[model samples]
Target: MSPAHSVLHAVFGYAQFRGPQEAIIEHVAAGGDALVLMPTGGGKSLCYQVPAIVRQRAGQGVAIVVSPLIALMHDQVGALHEAGVEAAFLNSTLDWQQTLDVERRLARGDITLLYAAPERVVTERFLGLLDDLHARGQLSLFAIDEAHCVSQWGHDFRPEYRQLTVLHQRYAGVPRIALTATADGLTRADIATGLQLQDARQFVSSFDRPNIRYRIEEKKQPLEQLLRFIEREHAGDAGVVYCQSRKRVEELAQGLQDAGVNALPYHAGLPADMRQQHQDRFLREDGVVMVATIAFGMGIDKPDVRFVAHVDMPKNIEGYYQETGRAGRDGLPADAWMVYGLQDVVNQRRMIEGGDAAEEFKAVLRGKLDALLALAEATDCRRVRLLRYFGEESKPCGNCDNCLNPPAVWDGTDAARKLLSTIYRIQQQDAGLTFGLGHLMDVVRGQETDKVRQFGHQQLSTFGLGAPYSEAQLRAVARQLLALGAIGVQRVTTEAGHAFDTLTLTAASRPVLRGEQAVLLREATAQARGKKTRRAGALPVAAADLGPDAQVRFINLKAWRAEVARAHNLPAYVIFHDATLAAIAQQHPQSIAELEGINGMGTKKLEAYGADVLRVVGL
Candidate 1:
């Protein structure tokens, strides 16, 4: 049998190949290594799986998969089993009997794929087993999922991953493939070096997810703002609400529940079963809201999440982008919202600095956080700012809050000068943050404070210089300055408790002369546009590629997707990812090969419904 036919028939029970899957499988089966950076809902799994099947058919041993998350390993194994593929995982969660059984299966050449943690693969026992498998010619290739974790500098670093390089030295002949959904240019280089995959062919897909509408709101009455947002944008959609603290997650979840929302809390602090229960409910139930800390969504495969709301600011822009990317996997419309405040920035900075990470790493993290701050305080297009951070140029998406409700601009140069001078005079010897902008503005407006009198700050010429504005307007100006790099927020919550603090001037803010009259200017430049809304390579498809029947089938598949999405309370793609439906439409297959030609149609799926798809297209 041909390698392609054998691959479809033996492990996956399909007759054709999917988008880029055939080429990737062909390359890997021929012993070439690869690096695939596809979107979350993209069929990254099949790129390795099909090749593993082909290798096994060619008398190779089991394909070794290095996965970071133990739960993700179990999920892959379950899916493989349903497809009739021989796969098993060895991890800390496995019992002694299960471990022995997996080892025995590997020795007998009964398993085509063996998934293990990077930690376990380097162990003496696993090495010995691997040696035996190699002797019997049972070893196929090494597939590394979430390969970005190998970088100690990455957000999801795993020190154990460094040991994976040993797999190359020990098993020199076997090919390898590394895959991940998220990585910046720096992180991408780091991963290639860290994993010693310098020679691997890289497959970098576009990072844009136009289905998700990016939105950020200033944390003014955050709770009320969140309530209004939820009511308007996602009244009955399944979504995730992310909080920075476990306590806040619980509180917000309970509050949402009390207010008649179907919300549940999930975090690492909770018991394992409870967390699992919440996750399972989120995956299975329609319209369930999972209120969670950052711990909840890593390696999670839920695709149809309609909204991702951040109750607090994320640590960095990368973290925010990755977290929000989880929504709208099926190429459907979704929302990404956050309520941010200055305190959130201060707290996150402290957290990053106080951690055991190196100073250089902290500096990198700080720059990323500052970029996110710019997005929040930006009066321009939210989508434009978000895309620009990822190195993509975009026009302003006129749909976001700032675009719809443009902030009124007033000449605040003189006002900013006054605040800067007051801050400089009060904390002359000591540079610190005294209070929130409102209270500071109150003091500046000549409102008597016993503390101000004790310090005698009301006597300064800058004090009460700009009393025409309300406290809110003053606070807004201070925030704008901070965003514009005209002022620096003092890192208030130090190792010491909040006894006394005040805003300090930075070199960036020193240029605003206190008494100089300033002009009010608002200019929207190179306007950020709405997301580039199109299917993957939509423009590249030939006019002849989609015929009348194919077009009809595509519409029907989308209809089915929408129905399933509504019924399952999932984002449409979570039910049947866009790539999968698109593949079905593109290949009006009359037989299994034509069906299998579409990516993501593994053996089990093809065996079960290959004829159904062909029949639907009346082929």
Candidate 2:
């Protein structure tokens, strides 16, 4: 048998490889390089991990994995050890003595996978260790996880990753594999260019996470909306609540906690220990609700996370996808719910324009944000639009908010053109000076505010042309224009030393204004009729619908899992994932022989826990 398949069964406790994992492992194990673009929970780790173990078992050398997330490193190493794989990690969490011991193990060829943070790597001392290993012919491979971090255009770009180019330079002959969960075509190309992996065989997996149910709501009492979602759909389940600001994170966490939800806050503003503890508890315990900024959740691998709720809009689609991808890792039913308002759009625009990034980077960021806004305002199936962003096509998912309860949409083509024309008209009226959305909307809605009169925008022909719509309607129109990329916001400072936004028309706007493009906006009235088109008490759990016998079996298996987890001091899902338990309960595997045929049950796991699982199934 191939060593890779042997390890896959004996160690990971899996019967087979998913998708391209086996092929990628074979290629990389044969000393070839690969670039893998798989979605979250798509068994990416196996591609490198199986090869790492295979090469080590073959007496080649130890594999060095460069990771960006320290917390994730800890979790992965623990899981590997449970699988009887020799794995260790080097990061700040380890003391000097512990670090020394890990290095010793790696050098002695006792460790199959040695995980290190990118910053810990590329150091002189680490390089020296690698050099020693290379001299001893004990270096198996170099694996760069989260390879998108190397791309400066990526949302989670880490400068430390750019220096990873040193790996190729130093270990010229070593086979390397780089993997990431989310990256667009441009970001993918940039990842290849930055990591110098342009020649590596690119294995791009489908970006579809079919298990997650996507839903977006226009913000109306966002906290209450989030509460309704949590209480009505996912109460007592593991979930993540993403906010846009540290302050908002704290407030929402406290609010959720006060509302009887087991919520906690995590952000860069909190003490390091506090942040770490919060993350640990969220990982190790069930029923935890983590309210955090984008600072959290890069490589979190908790498989049973039931939902991910965004209290505010993420800056871009990449960020949104990465954040939402954290849910439903167990491939069970999960929800990706979000509530975004006009303020969220404006705030994101200000952040993009007022930030310190280069023009090229900002331009890329704008495209991503615009795409996200389009998704938010989409009248069709959200899944189709989201997949299209990643260059994939599919039929309506029929499970997303749009599919189940379609939002009312209005033709905003004329409103969009008016908004874009207002920007162009203001530019002409003020000798190329432009105003922000507020001023432009004020003039369009015919609100003779002080800024409008002072700027003489009231005199423009476009002024008062949009008087048919109310102020709120005008605001909605402006947001749709920005979302559609018809209008863009820019940073501007006036002579009086006041900082404000300047509106600009995009290339996408010209066609819309010339009566060549159609625009659809979610009707503003939908927010008022929220949750009315559908009848729902709670989001349906995937396994909740099992028949009475299977249901009882599932409960019994879950109870056994809990007892085992408590005794082992591990998370319940870690002992056996929900999906695995569901399979066992449904099939009623009454003996070790029958259980051995289960997908997630490995030889080691079956030998250790198979009897217990069978007993729970009434053997």
Candidate 3:
């Protein structure tokens, strides 16, 4: 067997490589640079890890891994330690003495792999260490994780990542591999140029995460709908709910807690120690539903997260895909659920236009947002549309909400035109006067409310023009018009400092207003709700398939794992994944030797926990 293959089985405990992993590993190990675009949970770490081990054992020396987050580095190093590999990380979490000890170990050639942040990797002190290592021919490889951060077009761009090109210029002899889970064609080109990897062998894997069921709904009583979704489908399951702001994160977390869910809040506004503690709890404990803003999830390695819900629309499709990809890292069935409304579109657009970015940059951001809006308002499969955003074509995934419960489409051309005309006439009658959705809907539907009569909008020709349509139907039209750029949102502030969104017509409105373009919308009906529920007493591992006795064994193994994790002060998955424990339970391995060939049972883990696992299974 090849060195990479041997390392895969003996150290990482996987018998076979998935997708392009083996090829990427071999190419990089042979001293070739590469840019790898693989999906989440696609064994991305192994593409560089096996090569690092092989080169280190061949006396090439330690590999340097550029990571972004401190929690990620800590978890990766801890997992490597569990696998009996010598790995260390240099971050602020380590005090001066501990940092000194790690540097000494690196100098002594006792470490195989080292991880550090991009900012630290470019520092003069770290470069000095790299210089010494290079002088001795002790630098094996350079692996840049989350390489998309190097590109301004990427969802999570960091200025520090642009400095990483120095690695290529300084260490010309070392092979480099850049990896990211989420990137489109534009972002990919930027990464190649930014990192000076234009000629690197590119390995682009399929971006489909079939295990996740994508669901997007129209926002109506969003808090109540979110609560019902949790209680019905994901009760007692680990998940993440993302909001658009820190205030919403805190409020939603409290609401979930009040409803008896084990939920926690995480955002950048919190104290550093508090955020760290909350993240640690989410990772270490079970049934934790983290309600967070965009700051929370970027390198979380938790494997058993069953769902990722979006309470508000993301700024772009890339951000949405990256966040939703956080669920089902174990390749189990999970859900990517979201609810958006007309206001979501307005808020996202307003933020883009309100930014101080150059017009060209804002235009690109608007384009990205339009793509996300298309995904949200899609009538076909959500997975297909999501994949298309990344320049990938895919068949209809039967797991998505659209595929499971197809919503009927209706012609909203008339409704859209009426909504647009009302906004125009209202502005014409009273220059610079704009109305929000509530007043506009009331005026269009011919409801002579106090605000309607006070503004004298009852005499407008567009009044009662949309009286035939229901409020739900007209709201749907308004959302589609906003998404299509036929209308725009202008933020208005009252004398009392109250802010509200007002509708305005854009150039794109001319075509729809003249009936030259048709507007199609999904019919808002109860039949559109996608129903997914867990079996009453089933475990995460398909209790019906496991049978009663295996279910009991799985539960026992989990209890034992929790105890062991607490003793070690590490996340439970760091010890052994749920899949590994499920395999042990189902196969009923009687001897430690029988557990040897299991997927996650490497030499170190099998030697350490195999006997105890057997005892838990009543062997």
Candidate 4:
């Protein structure tokens, strides 16, 4: 049998490889490099892990994994140890004694996987030690996690990642694999070039995350909306509530706790130990919610997270996708709820324009935001829109709000054109969203608002033409334009009442007809009405649905899993995935022999729990 398959069975207790895992492992085990792009939760780890174990068995050497997040390193090492793999990590969080102990283990060739962040990896001390290990044939492979960070244009760009090429040049014989969950075509190309993977095999999995249900809501009373969403959708489940501001994160966490939800706040502003403790609790305890800014939740791997809600719009869709991808890793139903508003668009724009990101990057970021706004304002299936964005063609999912209950959509095509023209004029004059709104009204109704007269916008022929619609209606039209990428928000404000907090339009705006454009502004409004449209209710299903039989089974399984998990402090799935339970239910295996027939259960699992599983099922 292949060494890779043998370890997959003995250690991971899986009877088979998932998707391209086996092929990728084979390639690396045979001394070839690879660049892998798999969706979040799509078993990216196995691509490197299985090969690392197999290569080690061949007496090659230890694998060094470069990870970006320290938290992820801890989690991965814990998981590997639970599976009987000797893994260690070096990071700032490690004490000198602990670091020295790990180095000793590495020198003795006892560790299979050693994780280090890119920044610490090329240090003078580390490089010298790594050279010593290489001389003794103790350096097997190099795996870079979150490879997208190497691309400056990527959302999570890190300067340290750019220097990772040092490992490739210095350790030319070590096969390498770079892994990430999200990246566009451009970012992927950049990573390949930066990492010097000119001859490496590239594995690009479908970017679609079918398990995540994408959702966006127009911002109203955001706090109240978030509260209602939590109460209705997640009665007894763990989740992450994200806010753009540290203050908002703290307030929301406090409010959630007051509302009877188990929640804690985490942000960069918190004392280091406080943040760490909160993170630990959230990781170890069930139903502990975390309220955090984008500062938290990069490489968290909690599988049963029931949902992710955004109190404010993220900077771009990449950030949104990566954050919401944290939910439902257990392959169960999970919600991605977000509340967006005009102010959110302005705030996001302010952040983007204020940053040092390049103009090209900013343009791309703006396009991504516009797409998100379109998803939020979509009157059709939310899932459809989201999948389409990732370059997938799918029918309505029939699960999201827009599918079960679509919103009223008004045409407002002419109104849309007029709004774009107003924004364009404002852009030409170097004004922002706040001023654009006033300028638009002046052109639509011939209204002589003082600013309009001073700006001489009232003289425009499009002026007074859209007077038929209310100011609110005009703003809605403008929003759709921005969402659709017809106009870009030029400036933004975050200090509580400046105009430009949300989205701005770019060059994608459709040109307006000066004489003919006025003709369309007066047309009938298109209504995107909600179908079933009742506000979301408390947990879609009652806890009582966990029937007596199911409850007993679930309890026994959870207890068994919990005991194993706590013994090693690794997440339960690292021991036996939940998918095994559903399979057990369907088969109701009556004996050790029967349990062995289950898809994921291997000889190791059979020998360990074969009798217990049979007895629990009343066989």
Where does candidate 1 have its weakest 10-residue lDDT segment? 535-544
Residue by residue across 1-619, what tens digits does model 3's lDDT show?
9999999999989899999999999999999999999988998999999999999999999999999999999899999999999999999999999999999999999999999999999999999999999999999999999999999998899999999999999998899999999999999999999999999999999999999999998999887889989888888889999999999999999999999888999999999999999999999988899999989989899998999999999999989999999999999888898999988998999898778999999999989999999999999999999998888999999989889888899999999989999999988888766588899999999999999999899999989989999999999999999899999887777788887777888999999999999999998867244346654334774333686788889999988999988888889899989888888888988888789989989999988888798888993
List, residue by residue over 1-619, the lDDT tens digit for candidate 1. 7676566665554456545666777788889888877766566787888888788877887899988777678667766765678899999888999889988888889998889888888899889998888777678999999887887656678899888888788887889999987777778888889878888888776666777777775576765666666665566667899998999988888888887778999988999989877887787655788999988776777666778999898876767877888887656667888887766765665566567878898778767777887787776877788777766788776766677667555677766777777777767733444665655676678787776677666777777877876665566667666655566555456566753334556766756654443434332222234333333213212122567777677767666656645654444434445456766787666777767656557666667556666666663
Name the 10 consecutive residues with the lowest summed lDDT in model 3. 527-536
Instruction: Please give the distance, in angstroms, between residue 98's alpha carbon in candidate 1 and its true position after superposition.
Output: 1.5
Give the CA lDDT, 0 to 100, for residue 482 in model 4. 53
Query: lDDT of all the models against the reference?
Result: 0.72, 0.84, 0.92, 0.75
**Pairs with backbone N, CA or C atoms under 3 Å apart (clashes), candidate 3:** none
**Estimated TM-score for each candidate:** 0.80, 0.90, 0.97, 0.85
Q: 7-98, model 2: which lDDT tens digit per residue?
A: 88878778788998988999999999999999999999889999998898888899999998888787788777667788999999789999
Task: Choose the strongest candidate by TM-score.
Answer: 3
How much does each candidate deviate from the true structure in C-alpha RMSD?
6.6, 3.3, 1.8, 4.9
* CA shift of 573, model 2, Å: 2.2
Winner of 1 and 3 under TM-score: 3
Off by over 4 Å in 4: 379-388, 417-472, 484-488, 491-510, 513-547, 572-576, 581-619
User: How many clashes in each structure?
Assistant: 31, 2, 0, 42
Candidate 2's displacement at residue 360, Å, is 2.7
